[model samples]
Target: MITVKNVTFRYKGNEETALNEISLTVVNHDFVGIIGTSGAGKSTLAMALNGVIPHEFAGDFYGEVLIDDEDTVDHAAEYFGRKVGEVFQDIDSQMVASVVEDEILFGLENFGIPHEEIGIRLEKVLRELGIEDLRHREIASLSGGQKQKVAIAAILALEPEILVLDEPTGELDPESSQEIFGLLKKLNEEKGITVVIVEQKIKLLCEYVKHLVVLDRGKLQFDGVPREVITHIDTFKRLGINVPPVAELSAMFRADGSYAGDVTLTVEEAEKMVREVLHDSV
Candidate 1:
């Protein structure tokens, strides 16, 4: 549904490129994850995909970004905003409404949807995220996770074809982070919306996202399965990407020939691996 070709960008007055010759495509209903260490260009790539790079942030942009075969540069930021729903790590920065329901309504109204339809969109989005009870509450009163979910609901109300999230759970506790990822997975798998998430929580993403892309120093260093990227412990260390604890444990088993399978990226997979080793010993 999206294509990026040989795209390189540098902020005005900056000598270095934020992204270098990056190219990739995402198909309909695809769940993709992009990961890298700080200053690796992951966030820059996300903004570029969502039409925020050159449209809102000035830069020396090179190459093109296309959505559904339409040149993103040809469209305004508002146009791409409807095609792509972006949830940033800082929910407050994205939110504008005082009430939860109004938060969802804001997008619909901006899209010029009819007044009657705004109500329908609001109800559907609140139900989809199961935040209906919080509709009347003040946005400032909600917790971090609740605020994040409301942020997502606001974007989801727009009914964008693709959802792009930048570290959506970076500030949440582990349980809340898990909930956020679970909601995103449900949206991708059950609702069939394309999802692109740039996150550092590789293990959570590995559990839900099948395709992974890795970046290093503004370069596309790796693109494939998360298991493939995480198993190369030495490379991950060199690139300053953290290998999840489960992946490290599985790596030890593989080194000893006690486990022979793809590298595990989630706790569930690690648990299954442990059970297999015990059964073999029995």
Candidate 2:
């Protein structure tokens, strides 16, 4: 479990507070999504979760972030890194090696995993990510989507209990973005890893994550299940966060008392609700 209590931070040489008394809890195996406008502190919060805020980033920080009962401030950045893996927005910047196999091997080798066990873990992660064919491919030769997978595979090899990603799909096309979310969902459900993702793609978050968090100007704006949180359509609009079209349609029907069903997060759900309403009218 992750506990963030009354945490606040300010970057060095910057007067503005990057985070303000933000407190949240992510239980084991929870899939949480953070969304907000640009400069909303989304990336800052992701860094905090992975022990970068107080340890690496030179900042004035207050409060505490605890991972599994241990305080993050008391340890070095690399300490929590073993338990929490982070993937940044730019996959290329995270790459430390030229080839895919070397990239995955680097983390295991650094952590002092036994030499004999390294191959097993590397093969497991490569197969888990379905990137075994790209094991020998040069990192620069892979497409944007492939590079993103390799970045994730390298992290997964570490067997971290919690995975934090800051806009992992920000550079990808719509199709690639969906594929990454699907992969995260699979890891969360099957491997039982806790996943925290900062994404601008509200529709994908709603479809995959069990909980939704919204941050604005370094403040905790909203935190709840996606269905409950999306109902604040006016607030989302005021904050300039996009609501899925299907959710908008569902809210429209609910506003007029035409459809008393749940808020639809996906197109298929909206279609079913629409057919129900039409059938009733007939």
- Displacement of residue 106 (Cα, Å) in model 2 is 0.8
Please give, for residues 162-281, the per-residue lDDT of candidate 1 as tens digits: 999998888889999999899999999899999999888877877879789988989998888777867778788898877889898899899999999878877888999999987898
Mark the regions of model 1 whose C-alpha exceeds 4 Å error after superposition.
272-282
- Stretches of candidate 2 above 4 Å error? none
TM-score of 1: 0.94
- Top candidate (lDDT): 2
Provide C-alpha RMSD values for all models, in order.
Answer: 1.8, 1.1
lDDT of each: 0.88, 0.93
**In candidate 1, how many Å is residue 44 off?**
1.2
Candidate 1, residue 25: lDDT:
87
Q: Highest TM-score: which candidate? A: 2
lDDT of 2 by residue, 61-97 (tens): 9999999989998888899887999998777787899
